[model samples]
Target: MPNDFLSPADQAAAEQQQRLLAAQVVRHDQLPTTIRTVAGVDVAYAQHSDQLVAAAVLLDAATLEIRHTAVVRLGAAFPYIPGLFSFRELPPIQQALAQLPEAPDLVICDGQGLAHPRRFGLACHLGVATGLPTIGCAKTRLVGSYHALGHPRGSTAELVLDGEVVGQALRTQPGINPLFVSIGHRVSLATACHWVLRCAPTYRQPETTRAADHLVNQELHRLLAAALPPAPDGM
Candidate 1:
C-alpha cells in the first residue's frame, strides 16, 4: 500500500474510520493486584516500505524469563499520524498476540495510553482488542506537560492532561532518561508504575519491552539477510 494511492478523500475516510474504531475500543477496569505474567510489544519497519514487523514477548513476572514470542508483518495503511498510532500498529499486534500460547496477565507497549489526544494509543488498542489489562510505558511523552523528575531511581512526576493527572514520568534509573507510564486499560497509574518498575531489573526500559525490541531487530535483520544480494561482479 502506498500513500500515493490514497486520494485526499480516501485519507479523510481513513481518519474517520480510525475514529469509529476508537469509539468502539473497550476500556477495562482495574487490574489484579498481582500480575503473574506480562507481555510487551514493539515494532520495526522495513526500510523504504510501508511495512512493519512487530514482535511480542511474554515473560513470567516472577522469573523474568520469556515464555513465548510471536511476530507479524503489517502493511501499514494508516499514516504515521499523531493520536492515531493504534490504527497503524495494532492490527499486526493483535495477530501476533493470537499466536501466543496463553494470554498474558498484562501488556506493555512502547507508546502512550490515556495520554494520547484520542486516549487510544498502542497499549490501549491491544488492551481493548484482547480484553486484557495493559499499561503504556513509552520512551517519550506525547500529549502532556510535566515537571522534571528527581535524579533518583523510582522518582516520578505527574503527567497532567487538561488539569487532570493522567499518568507519570518515571525515572527507572538514576540520572537516566525517564519513561512515560500510563494506565492503558484495567489498571491504575499507580499499578502501571509498580509493574513497570518491577519489570525494569537493571535498565531504563522494562525487561519485557526490551526483549520485544530485541526480537524486532533480530527478526528484521534475519529477514533482510535472507533476501537476495547484489552480484559480486555488479551485474
Candidate 2:
C-alpha cells in the first residue's frame, strides 16, 4: 500500500496536513523520571537522487549499550521542502521504527522540534504518530538566535523564535559545537536538554545520535553496494 500522506498533491494539501498534525502535536512535561531505553532516528540521502536510507537505533539509557537497530532504504516518497522535511523522510523512518523489536521509552530525533516555524518538525510528527516521548536534537541552527554561551560542559543559552523561547542551545561537552534541544511531544525543554546531556557524557552529540549515525552509514554503504551494477567480465 502507498503512503498518501507522504506526497501532498499540492501546496494547499501540504499546509493542511501540517495543520492537522500540528493540532495533534503535544508539547509538555510528560517525561519518564528514569529512562531505561532511548532511541534515535536519522536519515541519509544518496547523491543526486531521491534514494534515502533511514535508520533507528535503540539503546539502554542507563548503560548506553545497543538494544536494537533497524534500517530502511527507499526513494523518498515526498519532495524536499523547507519546514516540511518530515514529509520527505518520515515514511522510511517509520518503516525502520516498525521493524524494531520493541519500542523505546524515549526517542531522540536529529532535527528540529517545537523550534520550527510551524512548531511541527520531524520529531513532533514522529512523536504524535507513535505517542512516544520524543525530543529534537538538531546539530545546526534552523530558526533561532542566542547569546554566546560559556565554554563549559553544562552551559546553555536560549534559542528564541518569534520572540519566544522554543529551544535551548546546550553545551553537552566543553569547547565543542552545542546541540539545539527542543520539545517534540510529551516532553519538556528542560527534561529534553537534561537527557541530551546525559546521553553525551563524552562527545558533543548524544549517544543515541552517534549510534544512529553509525548504523545509518552502515546501511547506506550496503544499499549503495547493492545498487551498483556488476563490473565487466574482462575485469
Candidate 3:
C-alpha cells in the first residue's frame, strides 16, 4: 500500500471511526492464566520514501527468549497524523502478525493504549482487530500526569487524565526513566505493568520491543541499501 495522505475530510472520518471503535476496548483481564509466549510489535520507516517495515517478534514469556520473528515491508497506507498513527502503522503490522507461525499468547505494542486523547491507541486498536490480549508499553507519556516515582525498580505512580486513571508510569529498571503502561485490551493495568516489567528485566524497554525494533530497523536498512545503486567502480 502507498501513502494516501488522506484529505482533511478523510482524516475527520478516520477520527470518527476511532471514536466509534474506542467503545470496543475491553480494559480487563481476559487472557489465559498461563501466558506461554508474548509478542512485541514495532514499526520503522525508510527515510525519504514511503517504504516502511513492521516487525513482530514472539518470545518465550518465561525466559524472554526469541521464538519466532516476522518482518513485513510495505508502503504507508495512511498519512502521518499525530494521534492517528495506528491507521498508518496497523496494516503492515497486521501483515507481520499474520506471517508469524502461531498467534502469540499476548502482544506488547510500542505505543499508547488507553492513554491517548481519544483513549484508543495502537495497542487498543490491535487488540480489537486481532482479538488478542495486548498491552501498551510506551517509552513516554502521551496523555496524563503522574507524581514522582521511586528510584528502585517496580516503582509506579498513577497516570491520570481528565479525572480518570488511564494508565501507570512504571519504573522497569532501577534509577531509569519509567515506561507508560496502559490497558490495551483484554488485560488490566496491573497485569500490563507486570508483563512489561517481566519482559524488561535489564533494559528500559522490553525484550519483545527490543527484538522487534531490531528486526524492523535491520529490514528497513537492508531494503534501503539494496535499493541504492551499486557503488561506482567499487570505490
Candidate 4:
C-alpha cells in the first residue's frame, strides 16, 4: 500500500465519497438460501507504524471449522480518520480475500457496517465492492444507542442512530458483553443477527471473527519477531 495520505481537502472529498457509496448498499437479503461457508476478515496494525496485516479466514458455516485462510501485509494508504477507516483498511482486506482458494458464501466483518455515521463502514464497503452477502459484528458501538439488553444469549435490542434503526446490540453468550451487528450488504438485520448467533455458539464473538483475529495477530507477531535484531551472544 502507498501512503497517499489525504490532505484536509482530500479528507472532505473522501467523506463525500462515503456518503455516495452508502446509497448503493443493498439492505435486503440476497444471500444463498443455505450458506455453506463464511469468511471472517480483520486487520492488525503495527505500533507507531503504518504497516498493517489483514487476514481472512474461511470456515464451514455449519460446523464452524476453519477451511482456508489468507493474509496480506501492507502499509496504510490513507490517514487515520475516525470515520474513514475503510479507505485505509479495504485495500489490504481485498487483497487477502483474493488469495483465498474459493469465494465464501458469506463474509463477516469485525467492524461496523450500517451502524456508522455515514452508513458506510468497512463491512458495507467490502460488501458493496465484492457484491458479497456480508454482516458486521463489531465489538463496540460506533454511533448508536440501544436499550439495556437481557442477560441471556440471543437477546437483542435495536440500535438507533439519528432516530433511525441502524442495527442491533446482541448478546451472543449469557452474561457477556453484547456485539453490535448491522447489515453490511445483501443481508437483513434480523438475518444478520441470526447468523451471528449461530456462528458464536459458545463465545462472545463469532468463531469467524475469533479465527481471523487470531490469524492476523499470529502473523503480525511473527513478522515483528523476524524483523527484530538478533540478540547479543551473551546477555
lDDT of 3 by residue, 1-235 (tens): 2323222257788788779889999988999999999999999996689987999999999989999999998887687877887888888888899999999999999999999989999999899888999999999988899999999999999999999999999999999999999999999999999999999998999999999999998998898789999778854
Q: Could you tell me every candidate's TM-score relative to the true structure?
A: 0.87, 0.93, 0.94, 0.95
Residue 107's lDDT in candidate 4: 95
Clashing pairs for model 4 are: none
Candidate 4's displacement at residue 163, Å, is: 1.7
**Regarding lDDT, does 1 or 4 come out ahead?**
4
lDDT of 2 by residue, 76-97 (tens): 7677787888888888888888
For candidate 3, which ten residues in a row score worst on lDDT?
A: 1-10
The 0-to-1 C-alpha lDDT of every candidate, in the order given, reads 0.81, 0.88, 0.90, 0.91
Point out where model 2 deviates above 4 Å.
Answer: 231-235
